[model samples]
Each structure stands twice: as structure tokens, then as C-alpha cells.
Target: MAIVALRAPLKDLAGGRSEVKVDGASVIDVLRALEAEHPRIVGWILDEQGRIRRHVNVFVNGELTREDAPLSADDRVQVLHSITGGTA
Candidate 1:
């Protein structure tokens, strides 16, 4: 299982969980498993096409990764919402 770490407000959506372990071969599979555990996070993490939303960032072992990126059992992942500041 890969350990998925949740950041800030996103953690709030996961019942205050900072991390979760899920069985998956890729980032998409991991997200699916997480969504099954916390249904409310489905829309927050994935878009209508089941793709990682543009505003959300995913990292595998500290390197940015796409939803299709492969995962290993001992891999670590982090999910964070992108923060953008408006122009003055």
C-alpha cells in the first residue's frame, strides 16, 4: 500500500486524516481507493473526467506526478491544493 499524505484543508475533507494507505498501481487507482473510503473527497480530488483537477497537485516521493504515474507498495504520496494569489 502507498501512503498518501493530505495537506491543510484537504485533510479536513478526509475526516482530519493526515494520511491514508491505499492499494494501487498508479496515482489514479490510489485516488479511487481514497474516494471509496471518503466519498465526499471524490469531487475535491478528481474532476468530471476522473482526472486530477488542475488546481490540485499530486506528488510521489517528493516529485510532482500525474494521475497516470505508477506507484509502488512502499511509495509515499502527497496531495495538496494549489494556492494562487490574485493580481493587485
Candidate 2:
């Protein structure tokens, strides 16, 4: 199983659960497992069309991950709300 951390911005959407464990052999599989338990949370990470949102960032084992990054049972995943503020 892989541990996935949720960002604070979407805490409400996740029922206040900060972290979750998912079983999968790859990033896609882990995400699918999360979707099964908390379907609503899927939208928090993935877009309506099932694509990762630009404002959301994912890290695997403490490193940033690509869209098709590889994952394993021992990998750690974290979701972060990207810093988007800029000078006005």
C-alpha cells in the first residue's frame, strides 16, 4: 500500500481526512483505488475529464511526479495545492 497525503485547500472536499492509503502498482492504480473509496475526492486531484488539474501538484517519495509517473506499493504520494499567488 502507498500513503497519499491530501492538501489543505481540499480538506473539506475530502471530509477532513488529511491522509489515505491506497493499493496499486502504479500512480494510476493508486488514484483509482482512492476513487473507489472516496469517489468525490477524485475530482479534487483529477479534473472533470479525468486529467490532473494545473493548480494541483503530486509528489512521489518526496519528489515531483510526472503525469505518467511510475508508482509502487512502497511509494509515498502527496497532493499539494500549488502556490499561485502573484504580485498584483
- Identify the leading candidate in terms of lDDT: 1
User: Residue-wise lDDT of candidate 1 within 20-66, one digit each (tens)?
Assistant: 88999999999999999988787888998999988788999999999
Clash list (residue pairs), candidate 1: none
lDDT of 2: 0.76
The window of 10 residues in a row where model 1 has the poorest summed lDDT is 79-88
Q: In candidate 1, residue 82 scores what lDDT?
A: 67
TM-score per candidate: 0.90, 0.80
Quote model 2's TM-score: 0.80
| Total colliding residue pairs, candidate 1 | 0
Q: After superposition, how far is residue 43 of candidate 1 from its true place, in Å?
A: 0.4
lDDT of 2 by residue, 12-82 (tens): 55677888888887776787788888877777688677666777778898898855787877788887877
